[model samples]
Target chain A: MWTWFYQLASPKWFYQFSNKLLPWFRAATFILFAAGLALGLLFSPLDYQQGNTVRILYIHVPAAFLSMFVYVLMALSGGIGFIWRIKMAHIVSVSCAPIGAIFTLLALITGAIWGKPTWGTYWVWDARLTSFLILLFLYLGFMALHNAFDDRKTADRAAAILALVGLVNIPIIHFSVEWWNSLHQGATISKFEKPSMDADMLKALLTMIVAFQVYFVTVLLQRVKAEILLREKLSGWVKKLVTNQ
Target chain B: MYFQSFKEFIEMGGHGFYVWLCYGVVLSGLVSYFIYSKQLAKRNQRNLIKFYKRMDARSQLNANNQLNANNEAQ
Candidate 1:
């Protein structure tokens, strides 16, 4: 099991696998996203109070979920790289940063938009919102710190350490509603128990989650490929690959 | 399905602009990434070719210098 895991840590293996997976992710993302959006926008029942504005939840919730999830993934991968000195884990962590940051921004913007009509304000310093904002800052901090180093290895290690240190925020972001007086609603779509939503709404939300997952995979593969090409520029295989292209 | 025309779909019950704005941002991010990756590959390829060309020129120069030294020694 450990050997298999180590094999996957090989950059060549990752590069080859990512090449095979990219197109599949792209195709699945298209199909799933179309289905998800259609179901969410067209089929789901309108909220009794929020009306069609509730539709934004499909995108908002998924982005919010992914932002936190991706951070945890980054932190974990970074930790593994730190412990084992696996460069691929470092690459994975670095690749995750900008993508996670983008999702964080999406969540913040969409959440604020959702709040304006629902909470009668566009901004709030509520716990859930504030923690998530902190998360965005953490992502930005990691990226900035990673780039500031003149040496790439130093950058990777420094950024990995930042990611590991920032891991505490993930839980705080998740449970902020439970911990404090937050206007933001608690988990609506992610709860494991029977969802509070009606069937159509639940389906729409779940569909959106799947769509977002596909989108993440698609983007991650593309980023990983770019990282590999950049890092392996002088390798014989890369030379052949480039010349053939 | 809710809206009758394309305009009404854009309207999205007064939330159209906000919703569309989110989609627009996501699209732009993806597009920018695609463009960035392509440009990066092109730059790397160009740099690699430049490096090989310089290396080849240096080797050729050394070879000519070595031949001239040999002739001088003779």
Candidate 2:
């Protein structure tokens, strides 16, 4: 098991492994997204209260979930890299930032759009919304700090530290609705015992979540492969691969 | 099939603007990111190949210069 872990830590090993895994992720992402969108937008029953506006939930919920999910992933990867001194872990941590940032932006934009019809306003300073905005800023900060340093190792260490420090905001974002009198709705799908959502609605939301997760993996693999090639440009394997190309 | 007709589906019962806008932006973002990352990878690969070819050519030139000096000495 430890040998497997160490092998996975190797950039060359991961590069090859991800190459094999990416195509499957790509296929799954496409299928899930198509199915989810069709089910949510057309097949799922309309909400009694929100009507068609609730269709925005299909996109909003998944993007919001991924925003926080990717943050946790980034923080964990950063922690592993910092503790274990694994170069691949550092590469993964950095690669996750841009993608996470994009999700966070999507979440915020869709949330605001969903808000306009539901809350009669596009902007709010509610706890859930505010903390989510901060989450976006945290991602931006990590990316900015990563690029600030002249040395790669120094930049990686600094950005990893920022990610770890920002981990507190994830819990805040998750529990904000419960902790405060926020306009945003509380947990619906996350309640494993008895979710509040209808069956088809729940299915569509879950499918979209899976689709986003797979999309994240697919893109992260591509980004990490590029990072490896650039960082290991002079290494024997990369050199040979480039020469062959 | 929730909507009775194509028009109703497109209209989304008068909330079409919001629903379509949200999905449209999200999809565009995802697709663009995928395309951008793939382009970045392809460009990096091209650059790496070019770099190695240049390095190899320079090394070959040095080897040729060394061989000529050796011939002069002989």
The TM-score values for the models, in the order shown, are 0.88, 0.94
Who wins the lDDT comparison?
2
**For candidate 1, what is the DockQ-based docking class?**
acceptable
Candidate 2 lDDT score relative to the true structure = 0.91
lDDT of 1 by residue, A1-245 (tens): 59866678878788888777877888888788889888987888878888778888888988988998899999999888888898888888998999899889988888887787788898888899889999999999999999999998889889999999999998898889999989988887554687888898998899888888778877876777778777776677877777676
Each candidate's DockQ score against the native complex?
0.39, 0.70
lDDT of 1 by residue, B4-23 (tens): 78887778778787677766
Q: Quickly count the clashes in candidate 1.
A: 0
* Model 2: lDDT of residue B1: 66
> RMSD per prediction, one decimal?
2.8, 2.2
DockQ of 1: 0.39
